[model samples]
Target: MAGQACLFCEIVKGERSAHVVMDAPDAVAFLDARPLFKGHTLLVPRDHYETLTDLPGEFLGPFFEHAQRLAGAMESVLGAAGSFVAMNNRVSQSVPHLHVHVVPRNRKDGLRGFFWPRQKYESDEEAADYAARLSGGLT
Candidate 1:
């Protein structure tokens, strides 16, 4: 069950909508609603974890294994040259959920250093299309 008032927990429990790309036993990967790039994805644990340190050690392997798959999908499924994977503890954690960001990258994609610039999908249909493609790549 989700922790009370946690946004990510709500998504995990199917109370909120997300463009889910991968739903594994340990983690769930979904497209970032406000993406740095179109295929940018966020992978979070099924349970609510406020930060990386809060995640139990037993879950580390499975959680990161899912992250690895999502990173690979950024290239294989999304046709990006590479991907950027990162996580913010409590300092910059927008939703306060333990989420790993897997952002698709290509040369001259306008991202520089650690400053992220957010963008939106042209429409919900477009976001769903990206989610479907990434889901297919993960399988």
Candidate 2:
């Protein structure tokens, strides 16, 4: 369910700001402000669904397609060996809206299972650069 108060809904409506990297008619991908890694991205549907179970069946394929695209871009644009793509239904989901996390991973990136230490962008310009590279990867 979407509400004007929902954080992701606000982002979708352009009431709030996010470092968006990819935009689609049904969903959008943006760099997480509090990233688990440099290119860590959060992809969410334009319409708000609180959890995976609430998401409509028809939206699943396209939503995940965006996730795949972002994951691929994570590796290609950021030099990650792979990506960790995941979503929380209702348990660990921070926002009320359904969103997937696509985190860039390396051989020894120090990310232990469930031990996610957050990182910050050196500067806004650097974050924008990462966004540009990711957008380039999409093309």
Q: Write the per-residue lDDT of candidate 1 for residues 57-104, one digit (tens) a residue.
A: 999998888888888888898889999999999897899889999999
lDDT of 1 at 2: 42
Q: How high is the lDDT of residue 27 in model 2?
A: 94
In TM-score terms, candidate 1 sits at 0.95
RMSD in angstroms between candidate 2 and the native structure over all alpha carbons: 1.3
Residue 139, model 2: lDDT of 48
lDDT (10s digit) by residue, model 2, range 5-33: 88888888888987889878999888899
Q: Which stretches of candidate 1 lie over 4 Å from their true place?
A: 1-4
Collision pairs in model 2: none
The lDDT of each candidate is: 0.90, 0.88
TM-scores, all models, native as reference: 0.95, 0.95
Off by over 4 Å in 2: 1-4
Candidate 2: count the clashes. Answer: 0
